[model samples]
Target: MDPSDEGSSGKRSDGQIPVPAPVMEKKKKMMKTKMVRFTQAQINNCIAYKEEEMPDYDSMPSIIEILSDDLANCPQDYIDELKTIDDSREEDKTFWIKMQNEIRDEREWILRQCFTKGYAEYEVDIDDDDDEDNKVPARVAAPPGRRRFRNGVAVKKNLSLSGGGSVRKI
Candidate 1:
């Protein structure tokens, strides 16, 4: 009898084999949730739009009135912020106009960045001759008595070819 199989097999009177303890797996660490916030540029864009559409005048429209028609899809927080700004500086046309221009500049800068990045990343396949200036290629008809399918039945190419120069129906 082999010494290695001494305890492994039930040959011995005791009939016992030592079993190794199972290793415990380490638990994965949970990742923290990231906070979502709008960029300064996006905020500025909203403010600028408000100023351009509704200028200062006697009995001018209220902040909510000005933004009502425009901000149908905008977030509640954004609309609230605009209203707060307007209420805080009531009848201060100069301050509002200055703020509007600053916001407008920032918004424009963000738009320019988006356009620049998009244009830079865009690529054209110059080597590919498949599509020439978006024009569709003319379809070529099959030769006489050379139908793609045999006996009106579809089959893969390179398998077999119909010998007769006439189409047959089963």
Candidate 2:
């Protein structure tokens, strides 16, 4: 048989038989790394959506959605804890900026991952808090009330020293 035709015979005369193409599988689809800005409502919906059903990714999926499912897979409070996170905390930490301290929590750490993957963005911008943040008014400090007097300099109006006395001045 012709040397070229020998290959067609399905026999290896050279003692070197290559594996069949059927055994080799196609490459897996890599998760989309593109960081898209999602509104806070959408993100919250995503969190809630995952509770009942899996999120269906389109032909392309954002990192947030994919990571949300991945991180949400475990028992965690990504949403409730996210609310308490201060804006400055997210703003100050970024890939571009070198950090003196480690990340604070899982949520922020996960969001900032976009930067390490080459997406330059902030956690706040990604959340798109244009409306969600506005709904809740900014926290204001309460008026300072009476001061504590360890030295007893300020006298009390109705201070009771002994149990028998109805009222006593300190």
Candidate 3:
């Protein structure tokens, strides 16, 4: 075969068989992360609902939808915050990014507390005869050396009951 005819014969000019094109890997869609904010009133309402009904895991999506609808009808405080962040993005990109991340984290934590942990805080006593007293609020007992706060925040301390050297005199 004519060496110049390699192009027509599907062969490389170097007398080697041509290899097919490498399979193109599919590109994955990148998820856009958006920050969501909640007002104090909305948060209170969600907490109240959680405490009153205490829906199970299956109802979490419905609870989230309710909160979203409430937010839609409420004032635009969250939108204002988003605008502020957007405005500052031109001046300081790093600070804006950090603030955005902090806002996202805080929003996630609030949702988790209101939806997941909130339901878990109330224990359902199925066998108890007293219906009014059956719904007991759960409490996390702290470890021997730990102290739990009223809001459920815990802190570890080297406390000595014998009035020993736990506290150092500076």
Off by over 4 Å in 3: 1-91, 119-170
Per-residue lDDT of candidate 2, residues 96-121 (tens digit): 23332232243345445534653333
Give Cα distance to truth, residue 32, candidate 1, Å.
Answer: 22
lDDT for 38 in candidate 1 is: 48
lDDT of each: 0.59, 0.45, 0.53
Q: What is the lDDT, from 0 to 100, of the residue 92 in candidate 1?
A: 70
Q: Can you write out model 1's per-residue Cα lDDT over 24-134, one digit (the tens) per residue?
A: 887544444443444666545544565455454547666788768889989999999988876765557667777878977866665665566531122233433333446
RMSD of each: 18.6, 29.1, 24.0
Give the TM-scores of the predictions, in the order they appear: 0.23, 0.16, 0.20
Candidate 1 regions exceeding 4 Å error are 1-52, 58-91, 119-170
Poorest lDDT segment (10 consecutive residues) of candidate 2? 49-58
Error of 2 at 15 (Å): 8.0
Point to the candidate with the largest TM-score. 1
> Candidate 3's error at 38, in angstroms?
11
Clashes of each: 0, 0, 0
Give model 2's TM-score versus the native structure: 0.16
Question: Compared with the true structure, what per-residue lDDT tens digits does model 3 show for residues 87-167?
Answer: 654456465567667766655567686676442222233433344446678898857964543454444455677643433
**Which TM-score value belongs to model 3?**
0.20
